[model samples]
Target chain A: MLKNVFVLALIVVLTLPGCTMEKKEKEQGYTARDELLGTEIIINIKNSKEAPGACDDIFERIKQIQGKMTVHNIESEIAILNANAGVKKVSLSQDTYNVLQEALTLSSLTGGAFDPTVGPLVKLWGFDSKNFGVPTDKEIQDKLNLVDYRQLQIEKSRDTFMAMLPRDGQAVDLGGIAKGYAGDEAKRILLSHGIKQGIINLGGNIVAVGTKEGGSAWRVGIQNPLAPRGTFLGILQLKDKAVVTSGGYERYFYENGNRYHHIIDPQTGFPSESDLLSVTIIANQSLMSDALSTGVFVMGLYKGLELMEELEGVEAIFVTRDKKVFITSGIRDIFQLIDGDFSYEQYK
Target chain B: MTVILVMNNINKWITGGLIVLAGLSFIVLYIYQGSQDHGQPVLVIYKNGALYQKLNLTKDLHKEFNVTSGGHFNTIEIKGKAVRIKEADCPRKICVHTGWLHKPGQIAVCMPNRLKISIEGRSDNVDDISF
Candidate 1:
C-alpha cells in the first residue's frame, strides 16, 4: 500500500508541470480570422472570455468603416464625394473625415509623394479593377493632372465636416490608409473591452496591443521581398505599436519582362522605380505607419531615411534592391535580422 | 528480531520496485520527447472562415487537390513537407504567387475567394507577420 502511494505521488509530480502548461496555453486567448477590406484580417485576443464578444464588435466596426471608405461601394461616402468632385462640398462622416485628415497630413508631410488623389492613377493602371496593364504616357499624364493631394479640400462647420475635390476628375482612394485606420479602430475596440493584450492584423498592417503572455514583447516578422510571402528577413519585437510595410512585390504584373507594381510614383505617374524594394514603418499609430510606408517607398532611400529620422516616434526599415537592410536608430536593437542573405546597417 | 528481519525485507522490495519504476518512467519520457521532435506539420485550409480540410504534410506528399467555392477554385499541391496553391482562378493570383508554405506561421490567402491555407505546427516563431 505504501509503495502504491509513492508511485501515485510520483506520477502526480511528473505530470503537474505539463498540466499547468496546458492550462496556461488555453488561457492564452482566442484567435479569429475574416475577410475584410479586400484582404484577410486576423484578430487575436489574450483574454479568452472576452474574445468572442470583442471580435464581433471589432468586425462590425470594420465593416462600417469599409462601407464608408471603399471607393467600390457606390453608396460609400468616398464614392459620393468622388461623384461631387468640382461640383459641391459633400458632407462626411466623422470616421471618413478623420481618415482623410490623417491622409492629407501625410500627403503634405511627404510633399505629395503619397497622394490620396492617386485614385485616378490607380484606376488607370487597372490596380483597382485587377486588369493590370501599363498605361500609355498620355493616359498616365492625363491621370497625373488630377492626382494632386492639394486639390483635396476639407472643411468644418461646427459639428459637421465636409470634403471636396476642386478638380472634376480628381478622386480620393483610401487604399493606402484605410486598413491602418481599421486596425486602429480594432485596437480601440479591444482596449475598450478591457482586453489589453492582443494582436490585430488587418491584411499586413499589424497593431500589437500590450505584450504577449508573460510580459514578453510580440514578435512580428518583416517579409523578405525577394522570397516567398512567408519568408522573413527580420523580426521586430514590439509592444503597443504598429508595423506597416509597402512593397512592389505585394501587387504587380509583368509586362514585356518588366514588372509594373501597384505603388505608383505621383511624380513619374508610373510604378515607383525607387532603389528600395520595400519600406516598413514602425509607429505608434497604424494610420501613420501605413501612409508613411507608401510615402517613403515613393520617396526612395535617401529622402525616405531623412524623413523617418526627422519624425518623432517613427522608425523605418528599408530593404534596398541590393539586399541591404537599413533601419532607423530606434529600431536597431529590437529589429533582429534572422536571414543571413541580407546585411543590415543602422542609418547614420 | 523476527519482525525486524521482515521490516528489512519489505524495505528492500520497496526500494527495488521504485528503482524499476523510475527507470521505466525515464524511458517513457525519452520516447515521448523523441516523438515530439518528429511531430508532423499539418496543412490547415480554411474556406470562408470555416475549416475546409487538414492535411498531414508528411503523409500527403505530392497530393494535388482542388478547393472550390462560389464558382472560384484554387489548386492546392502538397509536395513533401510543403504546400502551395499551384493554380487559382482569382484574378490577381496572389495566392499562387505566394509560393510554397512549409513552416509554421506561413500562410497563403486568396482574398477574392475567401480561402486561406496555413501550415499548423506546435509553436510559431512570431506572433504575426507584416508584409
Candidate 2:
C-alpha cells in the first residue's frame, strides 16, 4: 500500500512540473496581419519585437516575388515568357528558374495532375479573372492543347536561364508554388531578423517557425472543407512544419444550383471531378507542401495516396465530399478530429 | 490478521484503480480545455492586411460603413451577428457575392478594394488551414 502510494505520488510530482514549466515559457508574441499576395498574411512572434523592420523587409521580398512570377504583371518575368511563347526564349532570374524547375518536377511527380501550365484552362474557365463563366467545349479543347507542363522548356546558361513555351498563347502560372516560396522566404527573413519563433500564415500556406510557447506543439486547425474558413474538422498539433490544404471550396461559383470550383483539371480543362473536397499536406518545406497540396488535390484520392506513399517525409489528410476523412498512417496520432460530423477511416 | 490483510489489498486495488482513472480523466480534461472556444464572436475588419476595426457581433446594431483603401471604396454592412459587403466600387463585386459572414473563422475579402472582413478569435488558433 505504501509502495503504491509512493508510485502515485511520484507520478503526480513528475507531471506537476510540466504545467508550471509551460507557464514560465509563455511569451506574449507579436502578431501582425496583412493582405498581400492575394491572401491574408498573419505573423506571430513569441516574446519580442526585436526586428520591427523584419515585416517590411519580408513583405518587400514577397512583393518582389509576386512581381516576378505573376503573369498578370506586364513587366513580370512570367509575362515576358508568355509574350515570347513560340517566338523566343525569355531570360529568367535564378528565383524564377528554380521555382519553375521545382514546379516541373512536382508536375511529373503527380503525373501532370498539378500543372503550372494549366493557365490556359484556368483562364478559359474564367477563374483567373473571376468572371464566373464557363468556356465552350471547343474553347476548352483548344486551351487544353496548350495546357502541357512538358512544353515549358528551360535552358540554363552560366549566369542566367532561359525558358520557352513551345506553343503560342501558352502560359505558365506559378500560383500553386509561388506562395510557398514566398513563405519560405518570409521564414528566412524572420530568422535573420532575430525572431526566434514565429508563425507565417500567407493566406492558406502556414509555415510554423518553431513550437509554440513552452515547447508545446502549436494547435493548427484544419478547416472544414464544407464549412466556412475558420470552421475546422480537425486540429493538427505540429511544430516547425508547414500545413497547407488545397480545397475545392477555395474559389468556386454557383450557377443553377451547381458549384463549379477553380481547381482546373489539365486533362478535362474544367474543374477536377475528384470526389475529394480538400487535401491537407504536412511537410518540412512550405514550397513543397504548397505544390503537393495542389497536386494531390488535382490527382484525387487514390492516385494522391499512391503518390504520397512513394514520396518520403510527406503526409496527407484527404477530406471527401461526404466529409469522410482519410489520413495517411503518419498523421494518425498527430491529427485530432474535433468535429464529430467528420469521421476518419483508418486505412489498412 | 488474515481479514485485515485482505481488506488492505482491496483498499490498494481500489486506490490504484482510482488513481489511474483520475490520471486518464485529467488527460481528457486537458485536451478538452485546449480546443474549447475562447469567447464570444468579434467581427474584425482588415484593410490592406491591417486591423481597421473590430466590432462585437452580439451588439444589436445595423450600420453600413465604407472603407477606402488605395482609392477604392468597399461598403460594409454589419447587422447583429451577420456581416457582409453590401456594396463596393470594385468591378468584380466578389465581396458582395461572399454573401454573409456569421460564423467564427469565416472571412470575406474584397481583393480589388483590398478589404477583408473576418470573425476574430473565439477559439483555438487555426491548426491546419483547410482551404
Candidate 3:
C-alpha cells in the first residue's frame, strides 16, 4: 500500500511540469523587427507556424510601397510626380493611387487641415534635411501658395490612373499617412497567415490585430509627450483596432527661446500653434487614425473634439499644453489614465 | 488477535506517513511556484534582424561590451537592471541619445548600423506604445 501511494504521488508531481510545458508551447509567440520606410517596424505574432514567412511578406510589401511613395527616394513615383509638376501627368501604381485617394478624402473631411500637398512647405522649413531653422515669413507665404491640396489633379481612365500637380512648385508628401497604411497592410498579412493575435508597430503607429492570448484585450500605452519616450500618460485596452498619435514633440528644433516642430499647418505654413500638444486617434482602420490625428492636432481642442463626436466609430484623446487630458465619449471607458500629473476628463 | 492488532497499527503508520509526504510535496511545489519570476525582464539586442544577445536583467551586475558589425561599432552598457548605448560610431548617435532603458518594451535603435536594443518581458503592462 505504501509503495503504491508513493508511486502515485511521484507521478502527479512529475506530470505537473509537463502539463505546463505543453501550455507554454501552445502560447509560443514569434517577433521580428526591421527598418522600413525610414522607421523601425516590429511585428509580433502568436501561435502561428507561418509567422516568419508572413513577416517577410509584410516587409516586402511595405518596401514596395515605400519605393512607390517615398519622397526621399528620387526614383520613387512620388518624387517623379513632384519633378514633373505642371509639366505632365505621371502614371501612378495602384497602391500609390489608393493611398492618394485616401489622403484626398481625409483632406476634404478635415477641411484642408490635413493637406497632402504640403511638401514644398516641408522642404522650405528644412524638415526634409538636417538644416533645421526658422524660415522667414515671406518664404512661408510663398510655400503656402504651393500648399493647396485642391491643385492636385487625379484622373482615372478605365485601367490607368494618373496624377499631376497643376503648379510647378506644388508637391505631395504622404509621410503622415503611409505608415498607418503599411500597418493596416501588415495586419491583413497576419490575418491571412491564420495569426489571430498580433501587434504591428510601425514607429508609433500601432495596429492591434486581435485579443491577446487567452482573449484579453491588448494594453497599448499612450506616450507622454512632455516626458521622454517610453513613458506613458495612460493605457488603452484595444482589440482589432489601430491607434496613431501626432505631436510636435516628435521632430523639433530650438531657435533662441522658441521651438519649431515638423507638422507644418497648410493654412499657416508654420508649425501648428494649436493649444493641444498631442492628439491620438483610435479607429478600426490605421489609415483613418493616422491622418485624423494630424488633422485634429492642427484643428485645436474644441474643434477637434467636435469632429470626434460627429464621427462614428472614431475616438480621440487630446493632451493640452496645460496638462489636461480629454477623451472622446467612445474611449472614456477603455482609456485608463495612469499619470497623476495630468487630469482626465471626458468631453461631452 | 495480537497479529491482527499489529497489522492495523502498521497500516495506520503507513497512511500517516503517506499524508505527510503528500503535504510536504505540495508545500515544495508552492514555494517553487512563488520563486518563479514569470514576468522577469530581459534585455535583448538585435543586429540586422538577427538576435545578437539576451541578458537576464534580474541579475545584479555591471558590464559593458562593444558590438561591431560591418566595420561600425556600438558600445552597450548594462548597470543593475537598466541598459543603454553608451557610445557609437554612427554620425547621428541617435541610439546613444536614447539614454538608459529599464522598463520592458522600451527600445533604442541605431538605424544606420542596423542595431537595436530593447527590454522585453512577458510581465509588461503594455504590449506596445503609441506616440
lDDT of 1 at B61: 76
Which numbered prediction scores highest in DockQ against the true structure?
1
User: Judged by DockQ relative to the true structure, which candidate is superior, 1 or 3?
Assistant: 1
* Model 2 residue A101 lDDT score: 94
DockQ of candidate model 1: 0.49
In the order shown, the candidates' Cα RMSDs to the true structure are 3.7, 7.4, 4.5
| Winner by DockQ between candidate 2 and candidate 1 | 1
lDDT of 3 by residue, A51-114 (tens): 8899999999999989999999999999999999989999998888888999999999899999
Which residue pairs in model 2 clash with each other? A34-B49, A35-B49, A220-B126, A220-B127, A220-B128, A221-B126, A221-B127, A221-B128, A230-B105
For all candidates, what are the clash counts?
A: 0, 9, 0
**Cα lDDT, all candidates:** 0.88, 0.82, 0.87
Give the candidate order by descending DockQ.
Answer: 1, 3, 2
Tens-digit lDDT string for candidate 2 (B19-108):
786687668657755655546688888777567898887768788888888888988888888888899887556567767878777877
- The digit string of per-residue lDDT tens for model 1 on A192-260 reads 999999899888889999998789999999998987776788999998999999999998877777878
Question: Which residue ranges in model 3 land beyond 4 Å of their true spot?
Answer: A1-22, B1-102, B110-115, B119-123
In model 2 chain A, the worst 10-residue window by lDDT is A20-29
